[model samples]
Target chain A: MQVRCPHCASVFPSDRAGTQFCPRCGAQIHVPEEGQVVEAGLPPFAPGAPPEPSGAEGPGPGEGPTPALPPGVREPTPWERRRELGLFKAVVETWKASVLSPRRFWPSVRPEAPWTEALLYGWLIGAVTSIASIPLRVWQQRRSVDELREAAERLEELPARLRDILRPIVESAGAGTTGDVVAQAILGALLWPVGFIILAAVLHLCCLLVGASRGGFGATARAVGYAWGPMVILYLPFIGWLGWVYAAVLAAWGVKELHETTWERAVGAVVIPFVVVCCFACCLGMAGVGAAFSSLRASP
Target chain B: MHLHLPPRNRTFGFVDALGVTGAVGLAIARWVPVARIVPFWGCVLREQTGWPCLGCGLTRAADRFAHGDFIGALQANPLGAVAAAFFALCVVASALHLAFGVPLPEVRLSPREARGARWALVVAVVLNYAFVVVQTRFPHLLA
Candidate 1:
């Protein structure tokens, strides 16, 4: 039977009798989606395109479990539809746009975009999180030794793991401030990966909400990893560069193969070399242009 | 998030820049005997009573791991050693995908699973922080 939502006036078919709120208008009437206890959210562009009316009308080709939208939702730009499922996200697409191509750090600051916010926020959050954990830690510390042990035991493997992280800090705290800073640094590195993901995601979602950009956790991680992940590791001895190089090259290839990439592995091969060459050509062109412009003089 | 990727020099952006920096930083630190760097940092950490820490040898660990010495990497820091292994796997899988027309490596989670995983990770971290604090204050019982 077709249920008409009194609010937004959208009429979609319901498999059962009773209905609830009109999703279109936020009105809570007595209508629901057939027998569905929970239903999917309405589509983004679904204002006009209602679901198939009741049974008398007919079943639509892409009805019921709505047909998947073409992988790329952008306008009429035609691209091949991969025969296999992608590896999680269109990682290759994201990689190409964000990591490989360079300009992809949208919504977030650009390389040249002032570092004011990021640096300030990073430091502030780092310090705050560090200080905040102190009391929480202290309260737990107050518990009986046996109780704490039991809790730690119950925790499986995480206590020792977490203790290893705080050892230097705790040991140093017996002394003074220098140790505190070191403690913070150690803590910062340990926590940054997880915290950064959340921060980046929030920033990205805000961007999307405002029609500013599609930045998200994945993109932010890639960007931060690209810019700072290496720099942080740069403090290491001789082999530090090796890690950075490895990460860099891997990131590059990943970006090149992001789009139309399958979860299987071979598609990346086809994409990388082509991208590498294309990348090389673009570099030469940029250099050539730079040289030409730098030596500019009137034809006279 | 909507990210605006400005133009970048592939030859010298993060990957390239970090490589050069790491090589130079390592060389300089090694040669300079700088009193304010990693080893020094380690010494200073030692001076402290050591509340406990996870990444004690991470920098060195990453250094060693990067050089293809998995054992050396572990010596520096086991966690970093693990991370290095994951990175290597990612590289091999990605490289193969790039070199041939193979599909990409299996992504760990679908969008739904991923969303769920993220929140779980956050909870784990907070709990970890609490665990560390408690352990530092009372080590014997757990130890």
Candidate 2:
């Protein structure tokens, strides 16, 4: 039987009744007996689309039990309560919840919240992390150049063939200047949002491909944004990249909770894209090698 | 990946895995004479084509970077040197985080941004390959 979600006004085909999750909005819906079925002609929201405006009141109390904070209702993250908590506190609370207490935190993440809010949070974290890590990356690059130049001075003692081969490497060592590093750093900070958004899209696409994405793109975007909590490690020396792993795991958890999907599907949504990209890159690389071999043979 | 991190002291779960893998990798790189064992381990593309492949000098670059010969690593392959430094950084950072219980942050992106990152990576790879070609085939221009 077709039942309309009283909370979000989304209509979906349902065979079973009782306390069940709306595939579209993930709201806990209580379907009534066939005699009590009210055929409301409200325009249904698209499947996996953001919740409609709350102007439409749910069925009178007689219809069923209404959840206090309906899944269709937008539950604002701490970062969104900047006016009440102040900006710093909001950021801190949100980051803490996302990274440390994700099990409790992800369920609170509403798929209906404006995706831009999460996007802004991710942007702030990424920009800060990039700016903080610049010093370390710059130091590493500088050390690399200095070491190369020193080795070049001793190249004279090496065999002629080896020296000839090493000369180009030495020449290119100084290719990146301080100015260049600064420019790259600035670009990275500015482009943080773009990178994050793309990552979320890829993951969402994977979710869709695997038939796992129950929530709209907004949910996926929010998941990826909140996942930025782990990226703070970027500010520290060494283990910054581990933030990527942690963030990925957090995002997957968020998807499972917000989308109301299984762990296998949520994890698959994240892993499939990575596997596909790696396989594609390997093939592309092999093709390049093959082309190079053919060109070499043709030249002779 | 269904790898759950406990609510409270989450650092211990994966720290051991990272520590073991990193230690084993470093030990092999430091103690084992991999270069001697694989004497013919050179870039086949470079050997036949007179032009350097994207990964042509990566091994040499890694070896130099591992030995604290940053300059030699850069001279061999700038990308490879960067990668080696990044690997070392991850190992050390993971160890410290496990020891100190530092909090990690999560990161998320929108679809547009994800596409942009992929494009940016592609551009970086192409640019790096171009640099390798210029340095190898036309060294005078750089000089």
Candidate 3:
């Protein structure tokens, strides 16, 4: 019996049962049961071309044929798709996308990317910000020194002993500030990983207490790491504070998405730790004040 | 290619590196006699208002502490030695974590504990800053 290849429109003798490739064109052909006539005159079906609409009913205007796909293929996830462009590009693109649309972007990031990559991403961003701010820091420091000098000059009317004491403090201003830029950059980069760990632990604890910790610690860490995306703008003058606020918002969004929890829970997870830390700080301040008062009372 | 280290291990590595770098920096600062040549950006608050900030002299103090000058470190800034100790501890903890997969214990403070810790830090900073201010402003009082 003869068969026609639907894909290449090649005609060949059908010697095998079930499915077979056309001998002339290599198009897959399905052999029929006995007594079926082969349609040998149909046009060849291009491998990647979309299937034509049924006879007498073509696709209407604005309706395009769907692209053909090989079997067993699936669309890439957002992270995988972004990563396909290369690491640097992926980092830049992801950071941009995250800053612009954190609500949408963060939810799309699954916990599949290694947490270390996220930590590195956060650290690099922090380091860039620190390096960029070196000039500003230097300017601020110089201004401070000038102000100190003026203050010391004003103290010239005080007792000679007082002047002697202030002299060393004022004079020491000129020492050991040269390599500060490198120090700041290294410290900034190094602090990020530690910060992330602390943040993750606090947030995870809060989530657990609040009964919203559906996701594991890994997911929470990933969320916090990606939340540092907004820190890319930390070098921007005046508006730099906004970057931190945006980062906080993004972190909440990330927690919500990653943990599949309520918005309140996510926000609480982030905010509660901060509140606790603040409370602790306040208590310490009060105790310091009380102690100072006690010492003053004890003094003549 | 990405590193095969787990996230926790990577974090440990970063913290450990930071601690080492800080220790090394302190060590160098102790040995180097280039203090007069290097510009010290002293405390801006003190420069502007004649009052020392909480962190004033911290770098110098840390350097002194790293060099085993405990008295000098205390006089420079009491908290400096504490900060140096923290960095040292971080280094040790990170090493243990990396080698044994043992993680830092999670802090789960009760409300009372949180309040106490916060108050303690606040008091420490305030008292320290007060000491600095008095020591700088009234050098005769100490005598």
Candidate 4:
């Protein structure tokens, strides 16, 4: 159930329904059941990204071997070339990974620590730190809310645009009464913190289901979308095109699985559908208009 | 712009656990004061000095903030005000969402705007710290 990634020092849930690699960071996770696949090796730093150069620590370079510079001058050997390339490649990839791109790092659910551990370990690791930091947290929370509040006021046509953006995502969530959809969204907006926490918790559970659990939820910001439903509040201030995007992603992820889980867990099941319908509708709508316009032009 | 809420709302699994954790924390803070956690009598390094340490009143400050005594909370720790306000917002907003499917459509800030907001908060906290230092050094400044 618990597997550690040698490269990243990460603990993951490896007891998958089937074989799975490290889902978070691409690493060769040893899955006991996967006897033959073990040799498949770690998903390279990236597919087709190329390995390190020869003569360096990583995979050798692409060159067969360094050729003689001139009749007298000597050249680096293949092993040397490979080593240099590998090291260079590794450093570059690490830097790229470290300096996050919104596209790569910021997803719908960022994931936080395992709820059980984050809270408990927090209690032990000097509760004062938690207690003392309350003010800072408060400051941050209010700052976020205040921003949302103003944005809501300034954007007079937010509803219309939101509808356009939200429609497709909503449709995907599943069918819902207008009131129900609105209420679910509003609920998501209001109790986002709790929603955020619960969202992370549920996501963690899902990761376990998939057998590629992440270690700690990590920082709150990192786990931002892990609890997408409540993050609506977080977007309140932005109330812009980007804010709408966050809302759509959260709703879509939350609702996508609602129908399946609704039967087993009636209440959460309801939310899942609601989120799905809303997010799906928004995404589809956005895509649909582009398609319609393009098709119109083509017909002419 | 238009905001939408799902007509129906449902609770998730983390609710019960969060509730229990929060309740237990609140109970401990209320019933057992932090100072009591220390021994009543012992030879201590700070025994010779009468002044409180920088972090002395923080626990009480948190307790007061949690209890909703905003003024008392601020007096205990300036950061207490911000924390109290935020915590109240969180609790209120969450309760509203639970009772009614729609969350209270409140305000928010994007990262861009927060640049200015961050400064404002910094100034407030700094001023609060100044007040604390002044009061501690010159008790008469309290008047």
Candidate 5:
């Protein structure tokens, strides 16, 4: 039987009964059995439809009156104040829920959550991940030492001029000690707030450019901060890329939910910045290659 | 029964294209001696752990495989040659799918088969690393 997705309005055949997510857009859909009454008040499927006005503009069906906040004071969110459940427990729970079900989680979040709390969460996750990577970092340092020793042995066989030229470079590269690793971890944790602020600003600008800035800068910042929940898995080898992708997905979903914007707008806001960064990296890489070639050609 | 799902987003196609471009670039670099003159960015994992990670030496191994040194490629990392071949197939498959709307068959593996595949991959990685260790520590055995 053919089923029309209520979210994207894409029609696809579904043989199985009951609730299933639309493959096209990952929206939840429920298919009823024969003679069953279709759910009432469900939004009708409309292709390329503009998003409905949020409760902030007008009271939508079943939506309550929008809450008012005093100037310069942001209300604490449940996720931020779950101290009764213990701080670590609350953080882990929040991270798990946000990462696993971002669509549902983000929509439920109060727009008034302080950006500072979000930044702290992001920093804490970064610090935890860095600490988790200590064992791997130590092993890597040991391997580096062995390689340096081997290189030194080989360097002894080279001519005096060649040896003199390469020795200093090799020595500098092999200078990573355990103290360096600890310092890097501390620095990474401390600098995470800066990264979060920059990311939030970029995304907020993108949202404004895309005409989806409904909840203001604070809302966007909060969304960006909470969306970094997936960074908890940054210590995992090989699969760490998954954490980055998941974080991006969460950020897009969070933006959409908090702004009450369409999926297209949210995705555009998230992905445009990423595409720009990639293009910039590619250009820099090409410039570097050109410079190297020029230097190689100029050398005697 | 096979379930045919909806077509994925063009972003996935773009990502696949990038992967194909990189693999093809690396393959071409194998034949060009000038490419070999580029500075080596040694693996961070290998430098830290005193052992090669799963992806260590993949570029060089792929280059060797492209130059018809299958044994050397295997010695460098068996997983690298396999991954190169797999990715090469993916490039062709993705191109065909994108251009002609040809759908690739989705193989649904049984639990046993999935477990077996995972174990096989683990074995390949372990055996490859063991070979590397032996070659590095006791060169005369391989010689």
Candidate 6:
């Protein structure tokens, strides 16, 4: 008997009449007996014809306005369809959805689209943010330099160790010219693609370690690329770090939706690597302290 | 495992994008004095805590590897050397795949194999960290 999955609309033949998993997407479904199929509003299966998605019919009654995708199916983002909608509109729409409504947006974003398209979207955001924020960053740097100088001058009253610690920061902050800051901004912006790829590789490795990378590296890469949407407003000084936090949140959501995994696994995949790095650093720091103490004692 | 040949007209994929970006980053690192222009303060972990971080010599390793000093890169950071070599491999693989339509071989591991690989990775990272610590702190032992 032919059974049509109400979720993804994929039709397949089932010999038995019980619960089984969908062949295409691995989703669980119930197989009804002959003439027992009673899914409302779902189209009947026609052999040799491509399965039509219920999303084409729009949301049913009592459903929310957001066109939520069914499990195991995804549509292309506005950015991926830029040829059809003009580039500017696509970029805006994609950015809006990614930053404002990631839960709805990420599930709908087709993970299998060419990764370069996603990287291009991220690069565009990074480049624009860097270019637009150059003056602001330069102004901030100048202000910080003055503040550091003031703090450095008052450091003599503090403990000797504290003074020693802050002196390098003050010196480093005061040393850079505005031209260097501008150059740094430009170069940092240009390196976004490489940085995103490297980040995705690390995150994907973490995902694999945590058993959350069911959708493969392409999906992870796409998620990381689109997660940069929040960084569009990284120019805002006080709220800039908040935007970064939101970007990380969106990345977690992206992994969850793209990989069709539980929230726990997704969050673990993102957080575990950083935690490991921190712990490793702490251990190394302790070892270094030990070595320093031993060397000091030996010298005497 | 079975081999899956990609379609003739494949779109730009993860490896391809990674290859392009990694190659560009390496090229810039090779030619440009990025470290000098950026005014990077040395690592805070090393400076304040009297310890070398896990990524202590990664920059020097990348710099050395960019100039074809493989042994020097390994001496600096074994993992960094491995990563540099992987990036170089990606460049070559991406070129062949993009230009000649040659598909990269896909390896699929079973659940048991994947578990083993994960453990192996953890062991490798720990071993590499030990190497980094000894090389940085007790150089005489290595010598």
Candidate achieving the largest TM-score: 6
Ranking by TM-score: 6, 2, 3, 5, 4, 1
Could you tell which candidate, 1 or 3, scores higher by DockQ?
3
Clashing pairs in 6: none
**lDDT value, candidate 1, whole model:** 0.37
Question: Against the true structure, candidate 3 has what lDDT?
Answer: 0.59
Query: Which of candidates 1 and 6 reaches a greater DockQ?
Result: 6
lDDT of 2: 0.65
- lDDT at residue A226 of model 4 (Cα atoms): 24
DockQ of each: 0.02, 0.02, 0.03, 0.01, 0.01, 0.20
User: Model 5: which docking level applies?
Assistant: incorrect
- Native interface contact recovery, model 5: 0.00
Clashing pairs in 5: A139-B48, A139-B49, A140-B48, A140-B49, A141-B48
**What clash count does candidate 2 reach?**
28
- lDDT digits (tens) for residues A4-107 of candidate 3: 66546556776666545567765444567782545432221223432211111111122233223211111122334555687677777768767777644654
Off by over 4 Å in 5: A1-78, A144-172, A288-300, B1-143
lDDT tens per residue, model 3, B19-129? 555555566667774445433334445644677766667767877877888788888887777767666676677667767775554333333444454467669888888
Give the Å shift of residue B76 in candidate 5. Answer: 48
Candidate 6: deviation at residue A143, Å? 1.8
lDDT by residue (A205-291, candidate 4, tens digit) is 332222212122232212333222222233223443443344444333322221111222223323443465465455445444554
lDDT values, one for every candidate? 0.37, 0.65, 0.59, 0.38, 0.62, 0.71
In model 3, the runs with Cα more than 4 Å from the true position are A1-83, A152-176, A235-237, A277-300, B1-143
| lDDT minimum window of 10 residues, candidate 5 chain A | A52-61
Pick by TM-score: 3 or 4, better one: 3
Best by lDDT, which number?
6
CAPRI classification of candidate 4: incorrect
The fnat of each candidate, in order, is 0.00, 0.00, 0.00, 0.01, 0.00, 0.08
Q: How well is candidate 5 docked (DockQ)?
A: 0.01
Residue-pair clash count for candidate 1: 64
Task: Enumerate clash totals for all models, in the order shown.
Answer: 64, 28, 14, 89, 5, 0
Q: For residues B30-119, write the lDDT of model 2, one tens digit per residue.
A: 667666553234555676678987676776777777777899888888777776675576567556657766533322333343345446
Residue-by-residue lDDT tens digits, candidate 6, A48-122: 432111101111123224333345325578998899999999999999989987766876666555667788999
lDDT tens digits, residue span B36-132, model 4 = 4432221121122434333334556768766767677778777755654554554544455576754333222232333344456568767766666
The alpha-carbon deviation from the true structure for residue A27 of candidate 1, after best TM-score superposition, in angstroms, is: 19
